[model samples]
Each structure stands twice: as structure tokens, then as C-alpha cells.
Target: MNPGGLDYNYEDWTTIMNMTAKTSVLNLTQEEFIYPGNRACSGCGLSILYRIGLKALGRDCIFVVPPSCLTVMQGLFPIAATQMPVLNCTFASTAAIATGVRAAMKRLGRDTQVVAWAGDGGTSDIGIQALSGALERVEDIIYICYDNEAYMNTGVQRSGTTPQGTLTTTTPLSGKAEASKNIPAIIAAHNPAYLATCSASYPLDFHDKLLKAKEIKGLKYLHIQTPCPPGWGCEERMTVEIGRTAVETGLFDLYEIEDGQMKLSGPSQKLLGKTSLRPVREYLEMQVRFKALSDEQINVMQAEIDQKWAGYRDTF
Candidate 1:
């Protein structure tokens, strides 16, 4: 049962799931929350996700953003890009600040949804402790980590979530040695009321996931793979294509974990077997950041992806 005392039956779930059809574009609200002009780079994946996500979230929500690309995208102080209320917080205090915001709303007899928006560095590395605490306490908030792999806003530095063999300012010649941290798996271990993985290439899928999260109570965590044109060394116009290719190559999978149960969704659902996935090399070749990766390194990545899918096939 939802907080509103409404039961979300299996049929209702099916209806929501089926709404991802091409015609579902008509289902999105015409309302605009994010303004047209902003500081976002050309072909920014976050721009696409932000627009659709706000439409799904509507106006009855508050955003707690950390010091990241979004902070720059939203503009400084007197000037802003979004049409909603946003609280700018420190890099490592996003979730803690969001918790305080939620408490304030409840004290005022308001039920506004509190959302914490942060980048990969802020989430998987710096702010993880606070996030883990929030999840453990089952805080009534939505936390979204827009993973662009590196700390893009900070001169493309290597972050905990930066993929292995991907060149960054900190790891220029040989690229990062450590593999990207499995953030979704880490977050899933907390077992929040709702958890989902989304990609910027599929905005409608993300929109539907946000809508579903809004209906649920307790901690809700969403991780989105946002493509960075400048950071990833791809052409500005190739952002969407790169993001789509990431999923098609099985480097990233889209799915939801509701109350500890996991299920594949969107394009990833159609790609159940390893044979259905495209070559990981295809995805890597598109980005200049992977230029340093040797053929052997690429093969290692591909083998890892295949092994992952093999496990998924066995489980789901």
C-alpha cells in the first residue's frame, strides 16, 4: 500500500511498465520546469535527464544539489536555470542537508519530496558515509547520483567511479588503474524502499522510474549514467549515442530494486543473454578517453561484462 492508502496492484505495475512505448511520449506533461538557457555544455546528457526528471517529479519537491556540474548548470546565486526551489549544499553534505530539509517540511505540515542530487565523486567517494547513514535510517528522501564517471566539474579528475583504462587528468598516460566502483551494488546493499539504475540516453525510462519513486516512501536511490562530452573526449553531438551504446554494449544495465527484489527494465531487459550485447570495444572506440586502452585491456573489460550477464541470466 502507498502512503495515500492506495494499493498498487500487479495490473497497475504492468500499466506503468507498459507506458514506455513510443506513444508514451504523449503521456509526459507539457509543463516546463527547467528553463531553456543554461550553463550546461553542448549535448549534455544531464540536461536531457534533468528536463524529463523534473516533469515527472512535478513542482511538489525540493532539490538538494551538491557542488558539481549541476551547480554550474543551475548558475550562481541571483541567477538560476531551473524553475523550482533548489538548495545548494556542500559536496559531502548533500544527503545530510536533504535530511534536514525533509524534517523542516514535515515540521511545517508539508509533504514535499526531498531530493539529493550529486555527481559520481560526491556520491561514491566523498559523500558515501552520509548517504549510507540516510539509507540505514530509512530517511524519506530521493537521492540521485548522476555518474559521468570522472569529476568533470573539477578539471576531469579521476574519481572512484571512473572506469578503468579511461584517461583522466590525474591518470593521463596509462589511464585509471582501478575499475569503477560498483555504486549500484553498494547502494543496493542498503536495501532502500526503492532503487533503480537509469541512463541519459533513455529519458522516458528515467521519467517513469522517478514517477514510481515519488509514489513510494522511505529512502529511494537512483543512479543515472550521464554522458559527458568534454570529460569523455567525445564530440558534443555524440553524447546520446555514447550513452545508448553503453547500455547496448552491456557496460551498463538498467533495472530497479524495489524492496530488495531486482528486475531488469528498458533496453537492458531485451538484452538478457551475453550474445545479445554489442562488443564493448564499440562503446570504448567512440570515446577518446579510452584511446589509451590496449586491446588486451578492452578484452578484459568485455570478459567482465560477459561474466556479469551470465550471472544475470542465471538469476533473472
Candidate 2:
């Protein structure tokens, strides 16, 4: 029972949460912001992420893209796949460019959000400096890193966000010497107005996040795990299921931090410590990239997740 709040048992809680989520989905208009007929892969997770993100953002915004899969998805100059205005920037200047756009719009009194959408390679690796500078200045823009983990557009090379024990062109069987860079933790230290990790597995959660960020001013960093079909060596149609397992397995916990307060949400909220948690093996066995991992390597991966869980638990 929900003492003093509402008399409800476990079943009632489940029904209420489901209804709340369903309401969120129905709340979004049926208007299609992201146009079809792009060069996106068969089941590209980022493409799905873009579609959902735009639905939450509506058409009253601009998209800033760098040399990533998104740029490819948006298509060549004059002709584009996306419906809204898109500005292409250099590999390491997406955030810097977005900052300028937001500044210009503010000066001109334009009521619109400037979204800097980039990939893991651009955000966590090369573009990190520019992004940090923008956030330090508290740039009034929304920066989202659609993390596919590796540089899939450039032949599946290992990126800064690529996890350990995963086979990439650069990291092969031995896998990365070090663990994936703790990007979310690093950015969380900056303490933006809003910071969250998301996955395409849950559309309603992803949409709600973007919608909430749109209302907040200043830097809003969203790191979304968009599992690459070919890069991660998973079936194209299995992306959503993999995304779900990724969270349940503690590989990609969904949580949001606002002004130094960190709160777990979505699947991760229930999985914290003992309420609910799934084994990492199920998440690992499905991906070819991880299929070649040795017992020791898998153990290392488990250790990493354990540590991450402990840290988040401590935050409470």
C-alpha cells in the first residue's frame, strides 16, 4: 500500500505506470517531423532515435550535425531526408557551432531550441573539448550524443565510448586495453541544467526526456545508446530488444541528474541493487562483437558493471 499517498498494491503500481507511459506516447502529435527515404540502415537505432526525438521537439527547432551517421541520414546539401533545417558542422565543432546558433537566435529574439546532435566519436572523443567549453559557458542549447559505441560510419573502428571486451576493427579480439571512457560521469561532474542517459528501447522515456529538456535553459546533455546493427554484430530487427537487455544487464543504466541531484529512472530505477536486475550474459551472448570474449574478459566486463551499480547506489 502507498501509505497516505494512495492505497495501492504492486499490481496497481504497474497499471498506473503503464497508463502514465501510454499517456505520454498519445500526448505526442501524429505529425511526422522526420521524413522517410533516408540512407539509414535497415534497423538503424539512431534513425529511430531521431524520429522519436523530433516528435518530442516538434518542428520549431534546428538540428546541428557533425561528420557522423546523422549527417549521412540527413543526406547531401540541397536534398535532405529530415524535414527540419539542418546545419552541418566540422567533426569537432558541433557544440561550438550550436552555441553560436543559439546566441544568434537569442539576439534575434527567436523562440526555438538549438539541438546539437552528434555521435559518440564526435562527442566523447574529438569534439569533447568544444563541448566542454560550450557547457562551461552554459550555452543555451541541447546537445545529444547518439552513442552507437563505435565509429560505425568509418568502418566500425573503436571509439572512446566503445566498451571493453568488444571486437572492433581497431581493437580486434584483444578488445580495448582500457574500459570505455566514463563519459556520462565526466559530463555529470559539469552539472548541466539536465543530463541523462537514454536508449531507443523505450520510446516514451526517450520522448519524455527530450520534451523535458526543451523547457530547460542552458546546456542539456543527453547520451542515448543506439545499438548499431552491423557494428555490434546484432540482428537489425533485434536492436530494440538488445537496447532493453543492455539496460537490464547494467550495461547502459538510464538516469538523470539535475543540479547535482542524481535519480535513476526507467528500467534502471527498478534494477537498482536488488529490486530487479538481469544477468550480463544475456546481453553479451546476443552480440557478435562480444561473442569472442574469453571468460576473463567477460569477468572484467561484469566487474565494470558492478562498480557502476555500486557508485549509483552510493549516490542515493
TM-score of each: 0.92, 0.90
lDDT of 2 by residue, 1-95 (tens): 23444544434533544355442543444557677899999889998888878877767798999999899988876787899889899999999
Q: Which 10 consecutive residues of model 1 have the lowest summed lDDT?
A: 1-10
- Write one digit per residue (lDDT tens) for candidate 1, span 1-316: 1334444443453454456543155445556788889999999999998998887777888999999999989877788999889999998999999999999998999989999999999999999999999999899999999999999999899999999888999999999998889999999998899999999999988988988898899999999999999999999989989999999998899999986899999899889844668999999999999999999998988899999899999998
Give Cα distance to truth, residue 286, candidate 2, Å. 0.6
Q: For model 1, state the Cα shift of residue 3 in Å.
A: 32
User: Each candidate: what lDDT?
Assistant: 0.89, 0.85
Model 1 steric clash total:
0
Model 1 stretches with alpha carbons more than 4 Å out: 1-23
Off by over 4 Å in 2: 1-23, 273-276, 310-315
